[model samples]
Target: MTAVTKIFHDRLQVILDNHVAEVRLDHAERHNCMDVAMIDALLEAQVWLAERVGVRAVVLLGEGESFCSGLDVAAVVSTPERIAWLLQPDATGMTPAQRLALGWRDVGGPVVAALHGHVFGAGLQMALAADIRIVHPEASLALPEIEWGLVADMGVSVSGAALRQDVIHDMMLTGRHLSGEEAVILGLASRLDEDPREGGRELAQSLALRSPRAVAAARRLRREAPAMSERECLERESGLQRNLIGGPEQREATRARLEGRRPRLA
Candidate 1:
């Protein structure tokens, strides 16, 4: 296990290995609650990975037992200062949760989330953003924002469309949590594992073994399959490569391979 650096004290830790990076929610003391600072750090990690070189896969996980409990109720209710900060716009001029959720789509590589314990509210949104999710057999997944007198945001509408409408409605409307087996049955999770971390790492390595170009192309296809026309999707493919080929990150990646060194960000 490589020593991942913690980007921010109030946020999480990120570890970049040969061709894989892992983002771990580090707020275990509070069940990895979604506070303003954690949201900012999550978005920053995505932006960093977007520009990263030689990275073919990413794993999203929580540092401790539970994946994430949800929004920090104390931060939202007891602390006006914290709530004010969360309401502030991010660098992309998006709300903190919006940035954190949408940023995953911008990351160039495939992301697989290793979910365990409780994954509720905004945490479920984060998990939904990943290309694949391998959840623990005992894990609980839910969307409880509606119970809090707020509509679900954080790109849930777009991403949740991938899951069955009935399943999505069941979780979103009633705030009911689904077990890993139930999630898989409902098409909410791709796989169930006894140990999500090991399963996630194995999947990441498998994905890393494939051609980076092909992986990226497949990601593009999957992301655009819903709303984009065939012609639009083809154009998107060309546009993505146009931005990547001969790019700074690609150059660094090639150089790193030849030099037998970890690729350094430009």
Candidate 2:
């Protein structure tokens, strides 16, 4: 194993090792709830990760009992200036709050979110942005924004499209809590595990063994296929394949298979 590099942000801790980065929310005393600082840290972390092409996989988890308890409503509402900053739109017309969740999608490669305990509102939206979600069977998952007199605005409009319309509507309208098992059955979660953090780490480590280029291509194809026409989809698929077919990583993968050895992909 390689030595890990740990970077601490305002309310987050990022550990980088051998192409896998663990992004842990560190405000455990408050169930790792998203206050202004936490949200800022999240967005900042994404910016950091975006520049590191060596980071092939990311495992997103919380430090303590819960992954996140969603936004700290009273805290945000108390500071008028913070609210304005949170809602400030960037060049893409996406508010900081929206990017805090959606930015994970653009962070170079795959993101595997480990969900346990309280995963609500903004927290769930953040998880939904990940390519894979490993959820604890007993973890509580909910939209919970309706109860706070707000809609699910943390990029749920984009990520929630992967889920069933009825299920999305029910969760959005009622703010009802669902178990992680139910979440998987309802298509909100990828899978259920007793220990989501460990599961996520295992999955991420496995992903790290593959070529980052291939992994990124797969993620891009999956994400963009929905909106593309069939002809465009096929063209995109072939284009991506052509880019990868004669690459060094692909050749190394072929050699490793022929040699019956594990691929040491970079």
Best by lDDT: 2
lDDT of 1 by residue, 24-115 (tens): 88998887988767766787788788887777788888978888888876566687876676568877676766666767877768989899
> How many residue pairs clash in each candidate at the backbone level?
0, 0
Candidate 1 structure lDDT: 0.80
Candidate 2 lDDT at 222 equals 89
Provide the global lDDT of candidate 2 against the true structure: 0.90
lDDT of 2 by residue, 1-266 (tens): 46365555559988888788899999999999998889878988999888876888899999899999999999989999988888889999999989988899877669999999999989999999899999999999999999878899888888878679899899999999999999999899999999999999999988988887899899989889878999999999999999999899999988988998879775
The TM-score of predicted model 2 comes to 0.95
The all-Cα superposition gives candidate 2 an RMSD in Å to the true structure of 1.6
Error of 1 at 265 (Å): 18
- What lDDT does the true structure give each of the candidates? 0.80, 0.90
